[model samples]
Target: MKCVKTQDAVGHVLCHDITQIIKDVKKGTAFRKGHIVTEEDIPVLLSLGKDNLYIWEKTEGILHENEAAEYLRDICMNENMIQSEVKEGKIELIAEIDGLLKIDVDKLRAVNSLGEMMIATRHTNTTVKKGDKLVGTRIIPLLIEQEKMEKAKEVAGDRPILSLIPFKKKKVGIVTTGNEVFYGRIKDTFGPVVAEKVKEFGADVIGQTIVNDDIEKITKAVEEFIEQGADMVLCTGGMSVDPDDKTPGAIKNTGARIVSYGAPVLPGAMMLLAYYEKDGRELPIVGLPGCVMYAKRTVFDLVLPRLMADDMVTSDDLAGLGLGGLCLSCDICTFPNCGFGKGV
Candidate 1:
C-alpha cells in the first residue's frame, strides 16, 4: 500500500482487482498514482456518478444518450426529482424528446446531459403486460469529478414518473339556445362544432336541443335532458352580457348549481359551467360563449377532460382557471393533444 510499484504487481490480476474495486472507497487519485493499481479503481469511478452512460453492446447499434437517459432515468430517478439531457457531444435528440434535454445546436457530434426533461413516451394499442420494458435510458459520461453528482442528486429528488393518460368514452348533450337559431335567422352551426368536439373524447352526443332565448323554456329543456340521463351538457350562445341571453339563467333555474358564470380565458372568457344533482347523481352543464363557436379554442378546452371523466365540476374548480387560463390559437387546430390548457 505504500509504494506505486508494489500496487502495479498486484494489478497483474486485473479481473480480481475489478471486483475488489467495488469494496474500496479511495478515490481514483489514490489508485492512479500507484503503478500496480489493484481492484481499487473501479468502485471510485462507479461512485463518481453519471447522469447517463453511453453504452454500446457488442452487436453494434448507435445508442443515443437521450434515448439511454429515458431508459436509465426510470431506473435512477423515479417518483421524484427530474433529469434531462443537456447538449454535450454531438446529438440533437429525436424531435419528441427535445423537451427532455438541452443541446448545443452547433454540436450534434459530442455528448452531454445538460437539459433533459426526465420523461419519455410510448404508445401501444395492442395491449401490454405488466413489467414490460417500455423505454430505454442511459448515463452520460464527461470528465466529471464524481463528487458533484451528490449535489445534483440533492437538487433532484426521486426522478419523475412517466405520466400516462387513460382515454375513455363520454356521453354528451348539446343545448343550443338563441332567438336567432330558434327563429331560423341563422343556421345552427354551434351544435355541430360542439358535437364534434365531444366526439374527440370518443363521447356520444346523447341529446340535442334548440330553444328560443326564453329563460323559462331553456331551463325546462335542461331539466328534461338531465331527466333523459345526459352525462354532460353544452349550452351554446346566450353567454355574453346581452340581456336576452338566457342560457345561464336557464341552467340555474333547473336546480343546477352554477360553477362559474364566467371564465378569464380569451375567446371563451364568458363561458360558464353548471352542475345538476338530484337523487345522488351529478350532471355537468356548460354554457359555451359565442367565441367557442368560431375561435377554434377557448375555456372549453380547460374543462373537457373532467367532463369526459364524469368528474364533478364545482364553482371552486372553475375559479382555478384564472391561472394559466389563456388559450392561443395557431394556424393549425391540432387540438385535444396540444399545450392549450393541458393543465400544464
Candidate 2:
C-alpha cells in the first residue's frame, strides 16, 4: 500500500496491490455467480483494467471475461438458448429464428459447448453440396488474461450457413396497366412499389411497359418483355373480372401455364400467377390486383422472400401466408417484426 498526501485532512492514502481486485472481476466470485454487485465494485474493478466486464447489476449477476465467453459459446451450441448477444453481463437474444434467412438457422445451434484453443465446424447442415463451406472461425487478442478469452476463441468458428453459391438473379418484367393512369388521369404508384420490392432481392426490372386495357396489346407487351430476357413478369392492375380487366387474359393468351388463378390472400386475393416454358426455359408471371396498391402487407409480403431466393412458390407457399396474411390496418405499423416481413 502507498500513502496519498493529496487530501488536506488526510495525512496519507494507502496504496495496495490491485491484482486480487482484477482476479475477483475475472471470476464471478467477485459478486455471486448470479448475484448482482453494487457501485462499490466499479472503482475497484477499474483499479485493474476490467473494462470488458459484463455487469447485470440488477440481477446480481456479473459475468467477467471467461464466463461471458462461455455463455456466448453456449448460445451458439444450444438451440433452446435462442440467438442472443451478451451485453452488460446479461444475455439478450431472439427467442426464435423463424425464416431469418434462406438457410435453416437452427443448424447453427447444434455444436457441443467446448472452449478450444483452435477451431472446428460442428454443423454443416449435413446437405452441403460440392461447393458448400459451412464455418469459418478465427482468434483475436482481447488483451485480458490468456485464460479469460479462451471461450471467445471457441465461438470464433463460424455459424455460417452452407457456402455461398452464386446463381443468376431472377430477371423480372413489370407491366403497368390501367387506362386512367396511362393517360395521366392519376399518378402511377404500383410501378414504384413493385420496382422497390424486386430490387431488394437483387432482381432487376429489365423492361417496363405501360399499356391500355386491350388484351392483345398487353399480350404483345408480355412477349416483348420475354424477348428482352425476363424470367418473371409482374403485371399490376386489371386482375378482377371487370370487362376492362385484361391483364389475366393477356397473360393467358401468352400460352403460360396458370399456376393458381386465385389465392386466399385478401386485398391481393385477385392476384394471378402463370408460367411459360419453351425448350426447358421457364418464365413465371404474377398478376397483382389493384388492392396491392395501398394495402401495406398482404400475400405479396409472404411470397416476395421465396421469390427473391429463387425458390419456386408452390400453392403450398401461398397456403402458409393465408393465416398470417390478414392485414390489420395498424395505427403505427411496425412491419417486418409485425408478422409481415414486408419491411424487407
Candidate 3:
C-alpha cells in the first residue's frame, strides 16, 4: 500500500477502510476499501482525521487486509456456520442454527500467536442461537506478509477452530430417588427441576419415576426407563456419601460403564456419570447430586449440553474441569455464560 495526501488524491482507490468516531453518536467506517477518492469525498475523509490515505499498491509477496482476513475466516469455518462479507478488513462467523459453540482453543491460540492476524471467538462450549455472532477474524494491518497467513493456516491444521454442535432432541427418562419424596414425607422438587432443565434443550421427558433410596428400586427404575425407549436416564438425589445415598450403586447395577462417580466442581462433587449399552446402542445414565435442586448451576449444567449434542463425557474431561469449577453464586445468575466449568 502507498500513502497519498487525502486532499491531493482524486482518483486513487482506498487500500483500507476509513473509520469515523463521533463521541457517542457513531464509530464506524466512513469510506470502505476500494472506494475511489473524489473531490466531494476528500472533505469527508479529512473530517475523519485522514490527512493521508493508504491507496491500493499491490506487492507480490504481500496480501491486502481483506485478502488476509479471508485466510483467517477459512481457518475457523465449520458446519452450521455462516460467514459475513468482509468489512473494514474483518469478517464475522454467525451461527446458522441454535446450538452449542465449540472452540478449538489450542488451535486458536496457536493461530493468534502467528502474528499479523487474529481470530476472536466467544467462550467455547456455550449455547448460541441462530444468527448470533460466534467469531470474528481480521488482519492487523492494511497489508501483511502472505507468509504470515500461510503459517496461521498451517497452525490451524486440518480442523477448523470453531464449530456448532446442534442440540439433538432425545427422549429422556427421569428417576427421582429419595425416601422422603417416594414415601410422601416431602414434596418432590428434584423431578420437576430435572425435567425443566432437559426441556430447555428441547429434549422431551418421556417418562418419570419416583423411587426410594433403596438401591434395588433405583436400579429397577433405570432399567424400566431404558426399556420404555429412553435414550438417556437421569437419576436424581441419593448421590452423596451418606449410607442412605445409593444412586451411584444403582447406576452401576444397570451394567453401565461408569465414566465418573465424582467431580471436582463445588455443589456437584458427588455427581455420577455412566453409559449403558444395549444392542450396540449406548445410553447415558446420569446420577445427579442434590445440588441440582438447590444450586442455580452446577457440573450438570456443564455436561448436559455435551450430552445433548451426543458427545460422550469421560473421566479425563471431568478431571480437566477443576480449574473453573467453583461458581461465584452471583446475585443474578448468568450461567453457561459464566466461567463455572469451562477450564478444559
lDDT of 1 by residue, 287-333 (tens): 88888778877877667755665545567666655655666677888
A best-first ranking of the candidates according to their lDDT comes to: 3, 2, 1
Each candidate structure's count of clashing pairs: 39, 8, 0
**How close to the true structure is residue 330 of candidate 1, measured as C-alpha lDDT?**
73
Question: CA lDDT, every prediction?
Answer: 0.54, 0.57, 0.88
Tens-place lDDT digits, model 2, residues 80-105: 22333432233332313222133323
Better by lDDT, candidate 2 or 1: 2
| Per-residue lDDT value at 258 in model 3 | 92
45, model 3: CA deviation in Å? 6.8
User: Pairing residues by index, what is the TM-score of model 3?
Assistant: 0.89
The residue-by-residue lDDT of candidate 3 on 66-182, one tens digit each, is 778898998999999998998666999999998989899999999988777788899887888999999988888777898888888898999898989999999999999887898
Which structure is stronger by lDDT: 2 or 3? Answer: 3
Q: Which model is ahead, 1 or 3, in terms of TM-score?
A: 3
Span of ten consecutive residues with least summed lDDT in model 3: 335-344
The whole-model C-alpha lDDT of candidate 2 against the native structure comes to 0.57
TM-score of 2: 0.55
- Looking at model 1, report the run of 10 residues with the lowest lDDT sum: 97-106
